[model samples]
Target: MMNKLYIGNLSPAVTAEDLRQLFGDRKLPLAGQVLLKSGYAFVDYPDQNWAIRAIETLSGKVELHGKIMEVDYSVSKKLRSRRIQIRNIPPHLQWEVLDGLLAQYGTVENVEQVNTDTETAVVNVTYATREEAKIAIEKLSGHQFENYSFKISYIPDEEFVGAIIGKEGLTIKNITKQTQSRVDIHRKENSGAAEKPVTIHATPEGTSEACRMILEIMQKEADETKLAEEIPLKILAHNGLVGRLIGKEGRNLKKIEHETGTKITISSLQDLSIYNPERTITVKGTVEACASAEIEIMKKLREAFENDMLAVNQQANLIPGLNLSALGIFSTGLSVLPPPAGPRGAPPAPPYHPFATHSGYFSSLYPPHQFSPFPHHHSYPEQEIVNLFIPTQAVGAIIGKKGAHIKQLARFAGASIKIAPAEGPDVSERMVIITGPPEAQFKAQGRIFGKLKEENFFNPKEEVKLEAHIRVPSSTAGRVIGKGGKTVNELQNLTSAEVIVPRDQTPDENEEVIVRIIGHFFASQTAQRKIREIVQQVKQQEQKYPQGVASQRSK
Candidate 1:
C-alpha cells in the first residue's frame, strides 16, 4: 500500500502553496514536502488511510483553475515509464466511459487527460506493467469511438527500421498479416527528427506478436545483407556459343561443375535481344571454386573462338552484317549492336493522345473534337460546351443569393450557364449547362469545381468527378432549355458540347427543380457559363424599368 498520492492533470498554474492550503482545508496531516511539477505533483500523507481519504475526497471533485484534478498513488519510475499515450479521444466523452474501457485490459494505475483541444483530447494512461499498456494500445488504437478514430504510436530507435522493413517491404507485410496490425514506420526526413516513430494498431495478442515478429525480421535481414557482401561473382557470355560450352548431354558442363564445385546458371532466353544477343552467367561458391571455374570456362571459349574464325569464310552471310570483332569472336571483348531499324519506307506512327486513352469523364465529354482547345487555332476559336451533374445541396451556393453569384461567374468567365429543371421527384441530382469558347470554358468550370470543394460536398483527398448538377425554377426552364430545344441545341452548337433538360420534374422546397450537366472539365465550364448568362439576362429584364415606372407614377 503506497502512501504517496500522485495528483495528475494539475494546472500548470498550480503551486505548492495551493496544494498545502487544500490539505489544510481538509484538516489532513501532511508527512513531508509537496513536490510540484509541470501538469503533475506528488505529496505524501502520514499513512495509507490518510492517502485514501485524500484520494476519495479530492479526486475529480476539486477544480483548480477550471481543470479537474486526478488523484492516485505515486507509481514507481519502472511502472510509470511503461505507460502508453492514447490520442484523438472525443472531447464530449465522459471519463467513466474511458476508464471502464481501459480497465478491461489490466490494472490501470492512472488515466490522465494531458492535452485537451477544441476537437479532441490526448490521454496518458499508465498501467501496472508495460505489457498491459501495450495490450491497451493494440486493442484500442484505430478503434472508432463515436466520430473519432484512435491513433496510437510508439517511439523507436532510428536504426531499427531498416531491418524491420526488409527488402522491398516483404518483412513488414508479413508482420502486418501475421500480427493483424497496421504497422507504420515513420523515418526521419529533411525535418531532422532524432528518432523514428513506429505505430502499430492491433489487438492485445496481435500487438505482442507484431513486436516479436518485427525484431526477428530485422535481425534476419541485417545478417543476410552482411553475408551477401562476402562472396559473389557475375560473368557475361554470348548466346550463340553458350550451347557449345554447355556441351552434348552437358558432359563438358558436368566436368567443370564437379571440379569447381560451383553452382552455375545462364540467364533466361528472354534476356537475349538483337542489340546484345548475350546472357549473364552467375556463379556462386567459395572463392577457390569460383577462381578454378573461371579458368576452365576461358579455355573452352578460346577454342570455340578459333574454330569460329576458321569457318567465317565458309559462311559469309551466316549472320547478316555480323562483326566478329564486335561479337568478341576474336580474343578481344564484346560490343553492343545498334537497334534494328524498321523495313524501308514505313509510315511514321501517329502521336499519342492522352484524353483518348482515359475512360469515364474525359472520354464521354471531350471525345476527339476537330478543334483543339489549346493554342494554334486555325479559325474563330471553336465554341466548346460541357454538362455537369451538381448535387442538389450545392445548387444554392452556385446560384448564390438571387442569382448574383451565377451572374458574376458568367461575366468573369465570359460563358453562358443555365440550370435545367429536375428530371423527377426521385432524382437526387440536377443538370447544369455551360457553353463558351475554350478559355471561358476553363474559367467557368474551374470555379464550379472550387465551389464544390469549398462547400465540402466531398473530401479534398477524393477525386472530383467532372459531372455536376443544379436546380432552376420550372418557369425559367423554358428560356434556358429553349423552344423545340432550339435554344439548347444552339447552346450546344455554340459551345460544341452536350446539353440535356429532362422532361417533367417535381418542384423542390423553393418550387425550383434539378438540372443535369455532363461533360469534360472545360466543356462543362463553358456550358455552365453560357447558361448563367441567359439566366442573368432574364433577371435583369424582370427587375429593369420597374423602378423607373414607379418613379414616373410618383411624379
Candidate 2:
C-alpha cells in the first residue's frame, strides 16, 4: 500500500488548501504537502488506514468546488500483497502471545521471521486472504501486544523477478553482497505466471539501497531489450545534468565517442516532460563499446550531481514536477536526487584455463565467447595474445613459490598463462607468453608491470617499462611499416611507444613474424591496438582486391 493518492476530477477553482481542509475535517494528517497540478493534485497520506478512508469517503462521493473528486493509490497494480510487517516486538515476547494477538483480528496463513541486526523483532505476517490482512492492519495497528508496541507497515513485496536474477543469477547475488541483503526468488510458487514475488531480507538501512539497485537493474534490462536493428543503450539523466555530459560545445560527448568508438545522441528538448524532466541519451555501438561509454557518461553525471546537490538542498523543489522519493532520495526536508549509478551487478568473469587450448595462434579451433554482462576496465574482450618479457632474475617472483603467484594471476585474468623456457643460461630476459582475450591480456600485463615495480625491479619513482611482442601476418608487415615508415612513426608518436619491425625477416611456418613494442603498459597497449588495426585494413584490402594486392606486393 502507498500513501501517495492521486486526486483527480478537481475544479480549477479548487486550491490545495481546499483539499487540505477536507482531509483535516476527516481527522486525516498528511505526510507531505499536496502537489497541485492542473485541475487535480497528489498528496501523501501518512497512514494507510487514513488513505483508505480518504479514498472511500472522497472518491466520487464528495464534491470539491462543484466537481466530484477521485482519490486512489499512486503505486502500480498487483505490487501490493496480503502481507503486513510488525516491527519493534520486544525480544522477550513469546510466540503464543503473538499468535493469540494476531488471531484476534484474522486467520493467520503464514508468518516469516525477518532477520535484522537489532534486539527488536520483525516478522512478515501473511493472513489467509487480502481482506483478512486489511482487517488485521486496521484493527491491530497502533495496538499494544503483551504490553509492547508492534509497529505495523504493509509490505508491497514483489516485482519482476527476471531482472533481479540477471545472467546466471548474478545480479541478485551482487545485491546480496553489496547491500548485505539476501534475496529469495520464489520461482516455484508460480512457475508459469509472469509475476513472481521475491523476498528481500535485510536490515532497515540496507533495504532501501537494495531496492534501488533492483529497480535500476530492471530499468536497464527493460530499456535494452527492445527489438531494434542494433541494440542501443538509452540513459535517462536529469535535464540539468545533460549540459555537463555534453560539455562546452560538446567536447565531452565527442571525446567519449572517439575513445569508445560509439555514436551518442541526446533526446530532443520537445520530449522533456514536466513530470519527468529527463533527457534520454542514446548510445549506439558494440555492447563492449557501449559499456565503456556508460562508465564515462556516469562519471560526468556523478560530478554534476555532487555539485548540484548543494543548490538542490537549499531549494524546496529541485525539479518542479519531479518526485524526490521516486529517485531514491528520502532526506528529510531536502529533495535532492543523487547521480545515476552505471550498469552494475554483472556476472563474475569466466574461469581461466590453466593450459592453453588454442595454443600459439590457434584461436580458430576455440568456440566463440558467450556475451555476458561483465566488468570492463578500459579493455575489450576480444581474443588476443601478448608475449611479455620480464627480467630473468625477477622471473622467480613472477612464478612465486611452486608457481602459485602465476596461477593466481591467470585465475584473476581469466587467461591461459605460460612461461617460456629460457633461451640460454644467464639470459638477460625471460618471456611470459600470455594467451587470452583482450581484457585478460590487459589485466595480466598490468599486474606483471605492477609486480615488477613492487619488487624493486625498477628504480623507485621510475615507470615500469617493458617490451611486448606480437605476431602479425608477414603480408601486412609493409602496411604496418607504411611508405617511408610513416605509419609506425605515427603510432610511436601517438602512443608514446617504440614500434620496431626488423627488415628481411623470414616468415614463420604460419606465414607470420614478430612485431616488437616497448613502452609502459598503456603506451604499449595503444601501439598494439593501432598496429592490429593496420593489419585488419590490409586483410580487408586483400579480401576486396586480391589482384591489386598482388600487384602492390610486386611493387
RMSD of 2: 22.3
What tens digits encode model 2's per-residue C-alpha lDDT throughout 227-301? 123344456565656899999999999999999999988867765432223566766676567657766776687
- Tens digit of per-residue lDDT, candidate 1, span 387-410: 666787788999999999999889
Cα error, residue 110 of model 1, in Å, equals 26
TM-score of each: 0.24, 0.34
Total clashing residue pairs per candidate? 44, 0
RMSD of each: 28.5, 22.3
Give the lDDT of residue 56 in candidate 2.
51
lDDT of 1: 0.54
Stretches of model 1 off by over 4 angstroms after superposition: 1-373, 379-387, 396-427, 431-436, 446-555
Question: Model 2, clash count?
Answer: 0
Q: Model 1 has how many clashing residue pairs?
A: 44
lDDT scores of the candidates, listed in order: 0.54, 0.61
